[model samples]
Target: MILHKDFASVVGVRRIGKTSLVRVSFNDLKDNIIPLSINLGRLNGKNYSVEDFSRLFLEGVTDLIKNYTFVVKLPE
Candidate 1:
């Protein structure tokens, strides 16, 4: 289903299973969609600004997608 073209945003409280529903739905479109889940809650107490949040989220998504491409894993 087209999102903005067909429907508006679905609003709900945090941790209310919104992501679960989205994941389940997105599964059906896996052939065309590369879903990325970022837990922005990681910034809960960090007091990150809007720009900070955007940067962090992008970095997290990039890492999630590219981690598998590395020839060797780094030590934790």
Candidate 2:
């Protein structure tokens, strides 16, 4: 659904399998897609700006590109 629709949100109560589902999805798609998954609970009461989220997202993506065996080929 995420791949076809470009977006999907998984929500459920704590201690459920939401994280597990996302982890499985990422593992399956990591070679072709870079994902940014954050612990929103850590920001529940904090004053975090969109720029902060963007920074964290980019950091995660760069880390994946740097550490994983995923390949990114630029167009000629």
Candidate 3:
């Protein structure tokens, strides 16, 4: 999925290793891809607006850049 640039969702009951499977897959492909994992569960049970979602999304992106800053080359 990473190689082909396809999106995937791992859906299952709680504690069923969905997160683990994705983590391991991304770890193995770390050198070949940038992985961004955002948990929207934080918004659950609350009145989340677009701004809230944007904040979380940007936070995820910021974290991804921090983690791969040395690994990926940026254009000038």
Arrange candidates by TM-score, descending.
3, 2, 1
C-alpha lDDT of candidate 2 relative to the true structure: 0.73
By TM-score, the best candidate is 3
C-alpha positional error of residue 56 in candidate 1 after TM-score superposition, expressed in Å:
2.9
Report the Cα RMSD per candidate: 7.3, 5.9, 5.2
How well does candidate 1 score on lDDT at residue 39? 65
lDDT string, candidate 3, 1-76, tens digits:
4356677877777777887899999888746777788877767547889988898899999999888777657899
In order, the Cα lDDT scores of the candidates are 0.69, 0.73, 0.80
- List TM-scores for all candidates, in order: 0.49, 0.51, 0.68
Off by over 4 Å in 2: 1-5, 28-31, 69-76
Question: Relative to the unseen true structure, what is the C-alpha lDDT of residue 12 in candidate 1, on a scale of 0 to 100?
Answer: 71
lDDT, candidate 1, 1-76, per-residue tens: 6454333244477879977787788777745555556666667666779987887779878976785355767899
Worst 10 residues of 3 by lDDT: 1-10
Q: What is the lDDT of residue 46 in candidate 1?
A: 66
What's the lDDT of the predicted structure labeled candidate 1?
0.69
* TM value for model 3: 0.68
